[model samples]
Every structure is written in C-alpha cells, then in structure tokens.
Target: MAKVKLTAVCKVCGSEIELPEDVMDGEITSCPTCGTRYIVRLKGEKVELEEFKGDVEDYGE
Candidate 1:
C-alpha cells in the first residue's frame, strides 16, 4: 500500500504541524508543544476529530 502524507496545522497557534507517526480514523493525538488535537474533517459529513495509529489497517480489522 502507498503511504499517505497529510499535513495538519494548529488552529490556536500559527504553527505548521504535520501528521504524527501514524494517524487513524478516530485516534486523537495532540501536539507536543501546543497540546492541540489533530482533528480531521470531511465534506458533507459530521464534524468530529480523528484518531491516531501506527497503521491504517488497524481499523476494525
């Protein structure tokens, strides 16, 4: 499988944050410095935060 390279930013601070070691569908991870959660959003869906995991296949499998 191809690795995804996603980038996230801190809303509180103007700091540029990148995706952690691994990001899941609902695993919430925080920033090491700003302590901000990396939330993910989808179009025409519900508003919620995402999860973090070392791999993507760990979701309900």
Candidate 2:
C-alpha cells in the first residue's frame, strides 16, 4: 500500500493545503501559513474543504 497526498487551496490565505489520501470526511486540519482551520469532505473521489463550524473551547478560561 502506498500513501497519496491530497491538496486544496485555502479559502483564506490561498495557500495549498495538503492532506493524507486516506483522510476521512469531517476531518479537521489547519493551514500552515495562516493557521486557519478547515473541515474536509469527500466529494466523489476527490476531497473538498470548508471552514470548520465547530465551537472552539478555551481551556485557559
């Protein structure tokens, strides 16, 4: 078995975001440049990215 990498353009910084080929739908990852969060989805054989909508908890609060 071999690993494949998937890529998407960040909606915020326009940087390319590379992800694992086995990445599942709703998996969360961050952009390296801007550190913006995104959720990945399976769009047929390809993947799509969307801004993460889940609430962020501040443990320091």
The TM-score leader among the candidates is 2
lDDT of each: 0.53, 0.81
Model 2's alpha-carbon lDDT is: 0.81
For model 2 the TM-score comes to 0.76
Per-candidate total of colliding backbone pairs: 3, 0
Question: Ten residues in a row with the worst lDDT in model 2?
Answer: 52-61
lDDT of 2 by residue, 3-61 (tens): 66789989999999999877888778889999888878888878788897655563113
**C-alpha TM-scores of all predictions:** 0.44, 0.76
Q: Write one digit per residue (lDDT tens) for candidate 1, span 17-61.
A: 566435454555566667766545533323334444344455436
Model 2, runs deviating above 4 Å: 1-3, 56-61
Deviation in Å, model 2, residue 19 alpha carbon: 0.2
